[model samples]
Target: MNRRAFATLDRPYKNKTTLDLLNSLAVMKFSKIKPLVSAFPTLINMNNNAVNCLIKKTLFPVFCGGETIKQTIPTMRKFRESNIKTVLALAIEADVDELERKGTDAVSYTRKMVDDLKVCIDGASKFSDNFMAVKFTALVPPGLLKRWSFNLKKLQDHFELVSTDGLLSRSNVSLVQDAFPNLDASIFDKCDELSFSDITAAVSIFGPNAHQLILNDPLSVDADDIETFQLLLNEIKDICEYAQQKKVNLIMDAEHDYFTPAIDDIIIGLARKYPQGFIYQTYQMYLKTGFERMKRDLLRLEKEGVAMGVKLVRGAYMDHERHYAKMNGLASPINETLKQTNDQYNAAVEYLIANNVPLFIASHNEDSIAKACKLIGPNSNVRFGQLMGMQDSITFKLAQGGYNVYKYVPYGPVPVVMQYLYRRAQENREMMNRLDKDKRYILTELKTRSLFK
Candidate 1:
């Protein structure tokens, strides 16, 4: 396809000041000056009046929705006018420390999270027929997840020597004879009956660092943990049901590899329960297992007669995943190279399109977007997605082509959302390099418009 065919930079600016600030930010990002890029988060946190004003004027408009949902409406309206939809994301990080400082009560934390999400859902329902993306971590305590991870790793290591025969059952649990000879075989027998409560109880006995003890056997569920898990499930189900009633789709955002397995399980359960494509899950294609997992999910959904709704991303947690894997002496779950990720991503797109599944092609890569456009010719069940600030050319181009496109517009208090902004900066280096090309496209469009004068 010709470059200009997908380069229609119709509304590059809401006004001249907005245009100038964007161009400046683009230049800074394109230069890849380390200190300049890295200083943004620090500046945001400095709480200086001048710095905050500048960020609100320049950075906020381009990327974020606004401090509140009401403030985001105008931006959402602008996209709607261009035949683009908005994916409303409340740009709040689930920082465990921040949560504790705000409140020590678990019930209070849960209530706060639900209330925040309700605002997002209500705001999104007003304009977009697209999904509202939420992080599961926001609803649950991060400490609990850490404890689960620690316990699971310990349990998996203990079973590493035992011959499981690749089966995860009570029979396999009994095979742990030599590993924990003094431990009651009854514990192995009760594996099937263990609940989250049992797990928490074991945590008290075995302590957090008890690597030697089987702790709460991974073979069984813990009652307390199950209660917490149920609470999370109930909260998400409430959100999904609310979204369904409001005609807004809900997507569970993928996070770090440490938490993703549980997140995936929860998303799958939600998908099964509310199957008409109302609830969706995100799959980050940068992971080596992403493609195969997508295939498996599709097959499972097909068997269950549920329409699978998915948003495919190139992933945002690359650095964190690599670092964590190295630190923990675990095999890295990320794809070895970008090319491998792209290949898997395209393959996933093809598979989803072929199977007539509801798909959100959430990418900014030109080639991937083009491939999806070709595969989705005359199909409305598929939509294109890009983040709010980056890839305007791709987003606008796809939308102008009479295709469904959505921008993930994140909105929250500026101080609270800086982490989200920092993440966008870190992840979009390649896309930022394309800013010069976008600027030229904008210049060309400006000249064309000037000719009419």
Candidate 2:
């Protein structure tokens, strides 16, 4: 693609000043951290107003729709007209209510967002099989996971209590007695048969970490939790169905390692139930085990007779992962070097593109994307994705070259954008450190753009 088309991907603005400032601020914001920044409140307060102003004045025009629904369509339309796909995401994360409420709200928001996107996509026929990206945390609820972890601790305490007390009274250990009746009934036979009130009192008074203990027990899957998950799956299925009917493809993003296993379980289960290529799971090639995991996932999907959709990213959580590992004296999950990450990322892309699974390459690197163009044979199922504000040169040029391309457009309130921008800035800075040449190129590009007539 020529620079003209590359420039049009970031259309609507008459000049490059906003985009230039956005890029410059992004460079500064990621590397700046305060001691009090450990808490979300401080971080939000520090950059919330300024970042929001930057977002509205610069990044939003370049990366997002307006803060509201009506504002997003025009941006989506511009890409659609250029034969590029647009993935709309509503960025909402908070320390609010429990998981069920959050999941419900996320589902509601997704439905609304999809409905809004459909009006433009249907009219223009420019959207792919999915028009939006979904965050699992948005649907699963943070508190549920927290509560689940808490319940595991409680279960461990319950185990300790029963081992010592030996079921002296129903009030003291009846739940265990009921849960494991075969474990020496003689220890409880002589014990008093406590009344319901006594049992409740004992549990309420002694089982302080009841939730945590329950979470520890692998067998402690609550029907309510399962039902809540079922609701999320149903909602996802609804979205997938709508996407399929409308020819949109929804790509599931890769999150932190702590949450990814559950996301994997959900995606695998859904793939088994739905054979279509509507859903995709992400693989960050930088991890040591990502390629193995991807190979296994592909095999599992093939065995289950489902079309696999895969997204390849270089990863966003390396610094946090490495820092935590160092603090705790544990081995890190991140690739030891950027070269390793690049190698793995490109290999995974080759695997998926070669395998004929519907694939999306989400990266900022030119070499890896060029590898994709070479590997994507005739009739290949692939799309390249890049963030709306970052890496314009690649996305626009790829779109111009006639390869499938999509812009990841994030939209929402100012506070949320602050969080997102912080992460983006951090990731870009890390990438700069890892790939020094790329940073030099960015400097050169900024200079060239400044001088461009």
TM-score of each: 0.80, 0.68
Error of 2 at 105 (Å): 9.7
Q: What would the per-residue lDDT of candidate 2 be over residues 20-39, giving only the tens digit for each residue? A: 53454454343444332334
Error of 1 at 210 (Å): 20
In candidate 1, what are the lDDT values of residues 280-309, reduced to their tens digit? 788999998788767766676675687768
Q: Global lDDT for candidate 1?
A: 0.69
- The clash tally of candidate 1 reads 12
Q: Kindly provide the TM-score of model 2 when superposed on the true structure, using C-alpha atoms.
A: 0.68
Residue 41's lDDT in candidate 2? 40
- Candidate 1 Cα errors over 4 Å, as ranges: 1-31, 44-50, 95-104, 149-223, 449-453
Model 2 lDDT-worst window of ten: 204-213
lDDT of each: 0.69, 0.59
Q: Residue 247: error of model 1 in Å? A: 0.8
